[model samples]
Structures are given as structure tokens and as C-alpha cells.
Target chain A: MFQFKYPENFLRALGKPLVVFISRVGELSEFIARALYSCVTPPFYPRLLLKQIINIGFYSLPVVALTTLFAGMVIALQTHAGFSSYGAESAIATVVLISVTRELAPAFAGLMVAGRIGAAMAAEIGTMRVTEQIDALSTLSTDPYKYLVAPRLLAGVIVLPLLVVIGDIIGIFGGYLVAVYQLDFNPANYINATVNELQLIDITTGVIKAAVFGFVIALMGCYNGYKSKGGAQGVGEATTNAVVTSSILILILNYVITGLIFTE
Target chain B: MNQENNKIEVSELYKAFGRKRVLNGVNLSLKKGESLVVIGGSGTGKSVLIKCIQGLIEPDKGSIKIDGFETVGTPRKDCEKYYATMGMLFQGGALFDSLSVWENVAFGLIENQKMPKKQAKEKAIEVLRQVGLGADVADLSPSEISGGMQKRVGLARAIATKPEVIFFDEPTTGLDPIMADVINDLIISSVKKLGAAALTITHDMASARKIADKIAMLYQGKIIWQGTVEEMDKSDNPYVRQFISGSAKGPIKVEI
Candidate 1:
């Protein structure tokens, strides 16, 4: 009587990844829940919140402005090329404005901030975890979630929308420059077309997406960093994982939100 | 020290990380105003035991009671009372890099006790003075300080709150002999001044001998030997002898 050892091994192999994935999802959800809970609780640190806002918002302005400006300019040039073939060159301003406000600015700004702020949060918290500073905080009667994670999450939610709003303005300005001087479109016509086509719903959709993306970025960064172990290599891995996971989540959420908001 | 009133009581403690059991059935008790040092080689779970008491790492099974209040599995809000009564000096100082020395020392006071900043700073400075650090060093960041000074600052932070109990994790691990002695002296004086119960875990024989009123040796996830310093010197246990003598040839196998 032969036992089905091969089938048993196959089942075990197949179940391993499934088990790991389920557990990872469970842990991530728990982390996000705790972070959100801490945000509303007491023992709030205004100083830390202010510091993170400055770090994540004020310092990020230049980079966000540059990325969206270039993105807007490129979008105008490309739309001019594509639409000109269809004899729709006058649509360049409308396309650039809608794309910048409803898509490019928010998405680009989210990805950029994820790369910058997400990695920094991960590295800082991972170091704290490895060095036992996080534990030290607990032993000192301070909750690490209340002290560290809450501030970052709040700052991210508040500041990303502001950055995206600024990005939208700069991006539109960039498109204007390219449309007028480079493409030789009449300046007055371009401005009128942009203003006529822009809608409150378009700007609101981007702002809402930016807010969600910001929360995801900070959540991933803090979760990965807090759980990091094994010293320097662990911290490095957490930093990489923070940026990767946040960027992917931002893109995925952007599509999901867009579908919800714009679906006919 | 009155044995009837135990400051901390740990019983049947068990902790494991994925199949590697770090602590098994560890039982120890410290009386009020007593100093107990747990000595063991690296990888012996000394740090894990302290962390369990501090509620930093939850043990798989254990009962840790402080002043007769059970701490294991207590809600964080309820545990704050226990945390406020205890102080810990981490193995690597573990100072917040973002904060200055004074800010670090005053952290518990400012954050937990809700003390005003100016008063907290004055208390921090007073604690620094107790640790033989000057007022000038208070404003400097931890990274700017020497390792010895950092250790002293860590001690200052630990004692600044005037807690009833203190835990020192490798207080003199990374220091010169003189600096180690200085730390040992500071630890002794701070405990005496506060009349606090102290629990220190270290592999340094000299530090352990100097700081402990009672001594315990941990091996293979259990306390293999425990006695007073004088009793420790005269103990006939092979594990204790081999450990105290720093001999490689013994019942305790060197992993290498």
C-alpha cells in the first residue's frame, strides 16, 4: 500500500504561499487600523506633527512643481502632435488642462512623494525599531503609534492635496508656455478654452485621489518600518519595500478611484 | 530589602521566536530596594527576560507582576501605570537622535507626566549632575557626545523620572574599562539615591559583580544558578565555576 506522499508534498507547496499571503494581508490591515485609531486618540504631539508637515509638504513643493510642470509641458506638446494629425490642434489647451488636473499632477506628485517621504519614514522608523528606540518609547509610557505613526499619517493626508493643487497650477502654467511660444497657439484662445473646459468635479477627483495616495504612502512606510528587524539590512529592505508598495498602491488606487468617480 | 514585599515577580516565563525558545520557565523575584543582576553569555535570553517585564515583548506564557499587579496581557491603557513606575537603560543607549540630551532626559517627564518644559529641563539637568555630567552637555545631541557620555546620559534619562524600579540592559557593554567602572558607580549611586529596585542583565563579570546585591546565572533558557555575590564566589556548581572563571572547557558547550 503506497501512501500519496507526492500529492501531499504538492499540496503543502501550494498552500505555503497562500498561507503567507493571507497572514501578510491580515498584518497589514491590523497595522492600518491601529494607525488610524491612534490618529484620533490623545497624547498628541503637535511638535512632531508640525515637523512632519514641513518635511513632507513644504520641502516637497519644489520637486512636485518641477515634475508636474515638465509633465504638463510634455502633455501639451504630445497632444498638439497627436491632435494635429486629426486637424484638432485647437483642442491642445483643453487636453493639457484636463490631463494635468485630473491625472498627471496627482499621480506624479503621489509617486514622487512616495519615493521621497515614504523611504525617509521607513529608514527612520526602521532604525528606531532596530536600535530599540521604539521599545524604549513603550517602556517610557509612550505609544509608538501615538508618538510616531499618527503624525505622519495626518501630515500626509493634509499636505498631499495641497501639493497636488499647487502642481495643477504650475502644470497648467507650463502647458500655457509650451502652447503659446512653442506651438504658436493664440494665448487668449488657449486660456479661454482651458477655463471653459475645466470643471470642479475634475479638480475634486484629483484632490480626493491625492489624499488617499498620501495615506497609503505613509501607512506603508510606517507599517514596514515598525515591523523591520535584523538590523541594517532589515532597515534597507524596509525602505525599498515602502517605496515599492506605496507606489504600486497609489497607481492601483488611482485607477480604482477614477473608475468610481468618472464611470459613465 | 524586605523579602515579603517583592517589587517584581516573574514566574513560569516562556518566550520563543519561531521555534527558538529564548526563555523557559524563568522564575525570579526582586524585593523592594534590591539590585538583582542576571548574568549569562550572549544568546542566553537575558534581554528577552527584561523586555518581557517591560511589556515591550509579549511572552508566550508568563506572569509578570509589579507591586502585585499582573502585567502580562494587560491593555496598554491599563499598563501605563506599570510603565510609569519603571525605567530602562537600553543596551546601546538607544537615545532619540532627533532630540538633545536634555530633551531625551526630560522626555518621560514632558510626554508622560505632563510636566512643563522649563521644570522638566531643570529636573533633567539635575539628573545629569547626579550622573556626573555637566550642564553644558545637556543641550548637545546624543550623536555629538562621546560613548561614555552617552551612556551617562542614558542613565540620566532612566533615573530622571525617579521611578521605583529600573532595568539596565548591558549598561557597560561598549565602553573602556574606566568608563565601564564609571557607569557601574553611577548605577550604584543612582539606585541608592532613588532607593529603587534594580534589575540588570549583562555578560560583563566585573559589571555584574559590582552592581548585584543578588546574582543569577541563566543558561539554556533557565536560571542555572542564583545566590548572593559571596555565595556566588563559593558556589560549587560547575556551570557557575566555569562561567566565573571564564573557562572554555566546561559542561557548558561553546557553540563554535
Candidate 2:
């Protein structure tokens, strides 16, 4: 009797991916632990930290502003269209303010930074890994985790909250521009509604989410870059993976944090 | 046996990447202030041997003693004492792009030894002069330098701390013949001046003859043959003959 080896083939096909997935998670956890350990340890590089803060926060402002502004504008347009049918168009300001402050600004800004700074970090570190610069640092008795990863991680954690705050203001202003000038809404009334509807908790939640997103973005970039192999192709793949993984992580964490903060 | 005479010794070194074994029971030793160059074809584990010695890559099983201290599997903090005495010149120079040429040379002094920047800068310029570079090149970024100049800068950085041991990884790989000779001469003079024990890995026969006081040929992850430079010229080992003659017809298969 000939029996089809369905379960056997299924297991064979699934085995490699399962192993890869498990190993990836293990590597990521170990990397994060080492990075965090380095963060609190001595031999800190204040100059590198300041450089990363400027690079990640100050240099990234224009992109974050542009992304959040367009996101806020689109939300206003959509909310106006939907609420006008029910004669609740006046509520557009409240909806835009709450959504922008609580979610879009942080999430969009995180994603933008992920695409820009995350990719750059991965490429730079990946190149350093391949060219033996990281090993050279080791031979020089310098720990790469302390010199390379910790500064970026600290900068990410510190700077993203500030960027998110700036992004929130720009986003709300974008909504105001559309609601008052384009949508024929009362400027004073819209501003009043926006201020009235926004709670301190709303902004805090987004700031907290921004901080976590920043850490995740920098971690993924540094981890993937440090672990890269092969050569130039490996660096390219790492950059892509850093951006994609950080973006997805930001979206996933945004939901998780939102659920935790807003749950009744 | 005088323990002070032997700067580094390796016994039964073994390292494998997954199924492919790169280093299999490799053994070697270097005397104080001696220059030993390992010559092999591409993919013959020459780089791996150097990396193992430097503790950049850990061996699967081995005993690596540097000045009588065991380094294999030693904790990184414990390994620092050995690393502090060592310097490496990477294949591609591997200078940090962010820092200028002089800063690259002074990195260890400033970052590790905590030397003042002004003093480190002076020392950097002094070392640069030793490597045949002028102070004018000090402020330029590494990207601004030529390949040969970059290699010289790398040499400057490697010798900046006056380390007791220096590693050269294919130092002459990407240079013109004249440039390669220039680097080889610089390496010889630098090692002689520093009185540093050196371990160099290369496939360039000309470089090996020029810089090596002793030569060891690595094949199949082992030192198949070793001798002084003159003895290397007259070696009868078929592997050595095949490699030195650059012949396609030999015991060493092309693997293709």
C-alpha cells in the first residue's frame, strides 16, 4: 500500500522557516539585552549621543512635519465629508484633534523616521560590519555596543518624543488650515473645539508611543546592520529589512499602546 | 623554554562555520619581534587564522596563549589586556569614514588611553610622518585619500600606540606593483622601528618574500609548510611549489 506522505512533507516544508523564525527572535532578544546593558554602563560617549540626537531629531524634522501635515489634512477632508451628511460637520475639529494628537502624528512621524533614519543606520553599520571596521574597534579594545549601538539607542529614545510633539502641533495646524479656509468652518470655533476636546492624556499617550517607536526603530536598524553578512547585497537587504520591520513594529505597537491606554 | 621569547603560541586550533571547517588543528608560534607571514590561495583560511589570533573570531577548540595568558574563550573584559597590546591593519584600510585621517590615527589614544586631544593630535601627526604622510593630509577625511595613501594611514593608525604586536591582513592586495613595494618597505621599517612581533596574511608571493622573515603556507586549514624566506624559495613541498610557481596543474585543485 502506497500512502501519501502529507504530514511528513508538510513538516519538512515548515521546518526551515520555523527554525529561522525562532533563531531570529533569539538573536533579536540577545541584541536588545546587550544594547540596553551598554546603555546603563559607563564609558559613555556623550559626543556621539549628541550627534545622533541632532541627526535623528533635528535633521528628521522636515519629513516628519510634511508627513503629519498631509495626514492631518486628509483626515480633515474625510471627516468633513462623513459628518456633513449627519449635520455633525461642526464635530470635525474635535475628531481631527483627537485623532491627530492621539494617533496619526506619532505613528506617521515614527514611520517617516523609520524610513529615513532606520535605513541609513542599517546601511552605515552594515558597511562597517562587512569592512571589518567593527572588528577594528574591537582590536582597539573598544566595545562596539557602547561605541556604536548605545548612543543611537539613547538618542532615539530621547529625541522621538520631542519630534512627536513638534509633529503634533504641525499636524493640528494642518487640520486647522483645511477646516477653516477650505471647509468653510468658523476658525475660532474650530480652534476652541480642538482645544476643548484634547486631554492631557491624549498627548501623553502619543508621546509615550513615540518614545517606544523610536527605540524599536533604532534597535531594529542597529541589530539588522550589525548582524549583516555577505557584502553590499547584504547591506542593501538589511536597510530594506530595517525600514520594513521598524514600520511594521511601529504600527503594531501603536495599536497595542492605544488599546492599553484607552481601554475602559 | 624562555616564556618571554615567545610572543604568541597556538596549539590545536580548530574553527568551523557550520559544516565547512575553516581551521583544523592549526598550530603556530611567533618569537618576540619576529615577522611571520602566512601565504595561501583564496579561501584557504588565512584570514580566519589571523582573526583567531586577534580574538576577533573565537575558535571552536584551541589553546591560544598571548604572552602566556590564555585568550581562547576568555571574557571580553579579560581579553582587553591582550587587545590593548595588539594592532591590526585590515585589508581595505577600514578607516572610520566619519573621522579625519589624524583623528583615525589617534582614536585609540584619545578614546581608550584618554589622552588629551592636543597631545594626541601631535602624536598622530608624528605617526603620520612615520608612515610617509605629511601633516597636510591629517585633516582630510579618509574618503579623500587615495587607496595607497589610505593603506599608509592605516599603517599609521596601527602603529600609533606603539603596540607590541601588529597584524597585517593582505596589506598589499589592492595596490600597484610599485605601491605594493612601497608598502612592504614601510611595513618592514615600521616593524623594525617598533620592534613589534608581526603576523601577516597574504597571497602575494612578492609581498611575502619582501616583508616576511619566516613564511608559513596554509592549505586545507593547516600550515602545510613553513620556513625562512630563503628556505621558502627552495622548498620542495609540492603544495609550496605549486603555489609559488602559480601553476594550474598541481596537487592543489581549483575547486571549480
Candidate 3:
């Protein structure tokens, strides 16, 4: 095996990508640190911050609403089917309430906003980067991190929890409509069961998860966009990367946040 | 040559991306209120040189003294005071698509100097008119405007702050010759009106001839020659002659 053999390019190829990936992670960490520092610095842009809140929160409502609503209804139907096999249909209300508040609402909202808002942020900032608008911002004596990244991070961290709260209510309502109207459960009794089992921890944990997810989405979008180069193709790649990375991060973080907060 | 008389003095500048050096020992000085134009072939690091001075691209080695204060390797916050008195007109206009045209023009005034919105709007309109744009165009988004008009708006934004020094990056590249001339005239007038020292980088020979009071030719990361436009016409250096003459045959080789 040791007989005068040159190593193939296989290790070189694999090592190159590995090194690039590690460097990319390090760059992203530095970018996030700068963004967070800009967030706390003075000369805050209230106009830009308000605009992003409306963008990330208000504009994202219909999509998040529709996603969570359908999610709740689907879970309601599925739980009724499974529990009814044991004549335990009465447990459906508890299942719907706990699942919607503790998991489904926040996860769906995060994914929905990641797809809608994250991609848009990447495309917008990516275009600005290639077009020299970000450079233009700097020559005007405005810090690009403060002007572009901080408002977005602040808006995401502040607004996503509010969005998740809305999603939680609408999602529970969706489950309620299914249980009372279609499944022949008593409206008053189903409401009683859902409300009785709604622990404060479920809602609080979901909100906390929503904030973390929001930060991830904004960070991925801004970071990808900021580093974009070349032309329209580069911006297209950034948009795709923003959505894909943020969605994966949301799912992975969902498990971690759930395990950390819900465990004894 | 007096230090206090110069607005910007860049000495022994060197920059490289990986193994490919873009600038090597670039020595240039702009006296206050003087117009110096750098001309070079495309991809010859003309833009990179300007960016290095703007502090947008950090040069590997250089001393860039803006108003006699060293800027190279200085912390960004410390450089902000230097940048505040400077303005740049980007080649693409680089107008903020998010804001209306007037907002784009007034951005620096309102955001950096903290001017009141109403006052800034008035100032924006005034600057727009100075750039040969009508006040009606103020409310329109930059995307709605034509390229020539965007350049005007870019010029308007550049001068809006009454910056002491101005940098123009390819101010006339994408426009037709006639529109290019009009922009050249406007650039001359704007620089004159502001009494601002101007540094422009362009490959357009006609634009360089029209806008430059003094010209410098950059080739392969060095200023091969520098002199007045008349001196450029008489330059015996084959590189400068080949560039100004637009000849494919000479010491300069075309990759294509």
C-alpha cells in the first residue's frame, strides 16, 4: 500500500470545500457581531426600523396566518382520527391546544417569514451590493451596518414574537372551528378543555423560539446579501441561500429550544 | 507641492487581491479645488485605486492623507470625520431604490447632518434644479427615471452636502455621446460652482479630455504618465499614446 503512490486530488478537493465552509462560518460570525454592535449603537434610524417592522411583521401576516391556520386544521383532523380509534376523541382538544401553542404556530410562522421576508431581504441587499448602493451609503458618511443591518435585526427580534402571538391565536381558532363545527364536539366543552390545558410555558416558549428564529432569518438574509458579488446571478444565489439556510436553522433550533426549555 | 495646499495626497499605495496586484506605489496629489482625472483601460484597477482612497477598499500599503490627516489603516469611526466632508458619484448612479429621488438626494443631509425633513426637502429640490432636473422629478423613484436622469440625480446627491472634495466614478460611461457631453458640462459646472477639488476615474477618452484639468494614465497598476490634457496629446510614452489613441497594437496587450 505504501509503494510509491501519489495522493489523488480527492483529499485536495474535499479539504478545499471544508476550508471554505469553515471560513464562511467564521465570516458569518463576524458579520453577526458587527450587526449586533450596530444595533446597540447610537444614531438609531427610527424610520428605517419602523419600515422593517411593517415589512417583516405587518406584510408577512397573511402568509403566516394562512400557513398556521391550515397547520392547525390538519393537526385537528389527524388527532381526531388517531384518538377516536380508542374512543378517546375527547383528548383532541388538549392535543390541538398544546401542539399549536408549543410547536406548530411558531415553527410555521418562522418558516413562512423565512421564505417570504428572508429571500426578499437577500435579493434587495444583494442587488444593492452589486449595484454599489451599499458603497454609496458609506461615502455619504452613513455606516452600512447601522443603516442597513441594524434596523432589520431590531425589527426581526421585536416583531416576530408579536407575529407568533397572532399565529397562536388564529391557529387555535382554526382548531376550534374544526372541532366544534366538523367533528361534532361540543363547543363549550372543547373550549373548556383547550383553555384548561393551556400552560403559560407553552406560549412563552413559543414566543422565545420565535425571537431566536427571527434573528436567524434576518442574520442569514443580511449576511448572504452583504457578501454577494458578481451580477444578477450572484444575487439570485444569495436569495436562495438565505431562504434555505434560515429554514434549516429554524427547524434545527426548534428542536434545541424545545429540548432546553421543556425538559425538567 | 505644499502639504497644506493639497486636499488629498496618496503616496506609495499598493493593493493586491490574492496574488494579482491591482495598484503598486500609486503616487498622486490633488491640490484644493483642482480637478484631476485618472484614465485607464477597463479592469486596470482605476476603480480600485479610487475605492482605496475612499476607504471602501483597504490598500495593502499606502498613506492617504485627507486634509492632511492620515486615513489609511485608521479605524473606520476615526475615518468618518474625513468621509463626512467627501462625496462620491458612483458610475451606476447607485441611487437608493427604496427612497424617492428627492430622498436619495437629501439622504446625507438628513441622516448624517440631521437636517429637518422639510428643510432637507427644500435643499434637495434646490440641488436637483442645479443638476438640470425639475422639481417634479423629486417624488419619483429612481427606477422610474432614465439612466441619464439618474446620473444627474447622482450628481445632485453628490453635491447636496456641499462636500469639500468630490469623486466621480465613470460619470459618462453608459450614456450616448451627446448625453455624455451634457453630463461632462454639468460636472465641470458643478465642480466649479462648489469650488470642490474633484478626482474622477474614467476610461472614456472624450470624457477625460472634457472633464480633466490634469490627466493621469494608469496601466498595469501604475500611473504611467501624468500631465495636462495638452501634455496628454503630446505624451511620447507608447502606453499613454496607445490608450488615448484606442489602439490594439502597442506595448499594451489585449486579452481578447
- Give the Å error, residue A133, model 3: 0.7
lDDT of 2 by residue, B1-256 (tens): 6767899998899999989999989989999999999999999899998898888898999899999899998887887888799999999999999899999999999999999999999999999999999999999999998999999999999999889999999999999999999999999999999999999999999999998989999999998898998897788899999999999998999887
- Checking candidate 3 for backbone clashes, the offending pairs are none
Candidate number with the higher DockQ (1 or 2): 1
lDDT of 3 by residue, B1-256 (tens): 5789999999999999989999988999999999999998888898998898889999999899999999998998998898888899999999999999999999999998899999999999999999899999999999999999999999999999999999999999899999999999999999999999999999899988898989988888888899999998988999998998899899998768
Sort by DockQ, best first: what order? 3, 1, 2
Tens digits of per-residue lDDT for model 3, A34-86: 99999999879998999999999999999989988988888899999998999
**lDDT, candidate 2, A134-215, per-residue tens:** 9989888899999999999999999999999998899889989999889988889998988888889978998999999999
Per-candidate DockQ versus the true complex?
0.87, 0.84, 0.90
lDDT value, candidate 2, whole model:
0.93
| C-alpha RMSD (angstroms) for model 2 | 2.2
Scanning candidate 1 chain A in windows of ten residues, the lowest lDDT window is A1-10
The alpha-carbon lDDT assigned to residue B105 of candidate 2 equals: 98
User: Which model scores highest in TM-score?
Assistant: 1
**What local distance difference test score does each model get?**
0.93, 0.93, 0.93
Candidate 3: list runs displaced more than 4 Å.
A1-14
